[model samples]
Target: MNIILGASGQVGSNIVKELISHNLPVRAVIRSRNPGFDSQVEIRTADLFNPEQLTDALEGGNTVFLLTPEDPASNDIIGETQQIINNYKQAIHANGIKRVVGLSCIGAHVEANTGNVLMSRMLEQGFADLDIEKIFIRPSYYFSNWLGFLETVEQYGVLPTFFPEDLEVDMNSPIDVATFIAKVIAHKSRSSDVFELVGPQKYSSRQVAETFSKLLDKHVELQPVPKEKWNETLASAGFTASTTANLVDMTQAVIDDIVVPENPDAVCLPTTLYQYLKEKLEK
Candidate 1:
């Protein structure tokens, strides 16, 4: 009944876990054939860029969950999302997915002109013309994004970034977003609702550094890495300059409050950054 894409990723994994536990039949499409998911759900693989696979994957499914990340090529997000539109048009005309919950950003549609907003903006267009229920769950900065720096911290006691030490950004753990998606999947009544999955409070980079210190029991420092240093740092970590620049834009966007989504339903969660960090460190 439900075809969830990117089920191997964090948010997708959470959705799969919740779906299986509830005894709901789910069709999971991944970039890879082996995603190590539960056997109760059907697992399939398809290249999102390949139209035939994408269309075949959408067959017999009434709902779809889309998770498209930024591509470093062309810097044309709308152009990239157009690929999805051209590819899925046949499937849309045939299978007719009733609802689409797109995982997008706060400025997804607004930043069409900006190169960094291309992917999300394209994703916005990918579903805009569809004749189906749509809910764009644009989440704030994922707290798990910090996990990328955990290796850096383990190697060196420093966390490098483009944001200021005291610059506060809205944050939410992936658990929050995943749980919200799960709630949407479980409740047929919740649709056409654009929810801003965010943390209950705001947090600064300095506070994040403090949280890391407490979690790691080490003096982890937040050192503001210059743009040049960012290039070398990310390159050493196996990322391209375009990817680095995209992240810089997003980080600055967070600092400028350009990417903060409004609270539509005011849903509350029991976990905090401390709780999330604690469990991660323990693991």
Candidate 2:
């Protein structure tokens, strides 16, 4: 059986749908009951932080999809994430799981001080010694991240971003990510592997604004939040001081061009920014 953690989330939920489309046996593990899953999916409620609940959730599952859910409001995000990783380690061992497919980030290879990316690094390192097939999927910036600024773009004709106007960054669609993950899980592979996933092309903030302009028929402009105001901006968004600091560091890392895939030959998914935005707007 294939067990999917964080099954309520976008990527996880899409993965569930993809697997179900293939008529595979799946157990969806979520913190709370969600009635949206198909009849074939076995829903299991389990808190990721609770060892006993997680262990029970993993019972009889041969392969597991693992990911650390984000808690941006936490005062100690790193420590909290580490604790969750420890719980997963314990639960995986107790259940004797055969394979683990981890959702990581592009900059997860960096060892120290990469803000949110550190969580992925910790996840990879935490399970390094475990005698199981480990496959880490490191995806670039998600195109869905831009959905948060849709209201601002629609109402004010302005797109707010931390990136520079002309700086191109790798991005991918969550649908593509889920599709790749489902295929990997369905395929029988014994050797451990790391796959870096990206979209067909890189996109700049200016290009995103242009796409919005074209879609909304308005003169949308890019509003790059200056580095000096990152802390102020994040704090106003209701993030804790520590969380804001970490986010600022992560933003800086991106601007400094530190977040690159370790493997040069990354798997490019066929989802352009314009296509993604067009579908989102149509929806």
Show model 1 residue runs off by greater than 4 Å.
71-81, 112-116, 263-266
Tens-digit lDDT track of model 1 for 1-283: 8788888788888888888889988888888756677878898887777878888888888878887755544344445566765665666567777888778766664652333555666676766676678877777667887887888787898886667788877678888788788778767764576666668777887888888888778998898877657667766765566666666566556656666455556454556789888888888
Model 2 spans with C-alpha error above 4 angstroms? 33-35
Report the lDDT tens digits of candidate 2 across residue range 1-283: 9999999999999999999999999999999869499999999999988999999999999999999788768898888899999999999999999999999999999865788888888998889999999999999999999999999999899999999889999999999999999999999789899999999999998988998999899999899999899899989988998889888888778888888888889999998988988998998
Q: Please give the RMSD of candidate 2 to the true structure.
A: 1.0
Cα distance off (Å), candidate 2, residue 239: 1.3
Error (Å) of candidate 1 at residue 278 is 1.4
lDDT of model number 1: 0.73
Question: Which candidate leads in lDDT?
Answer: 2
lDDT of each: 0.73, 0.92
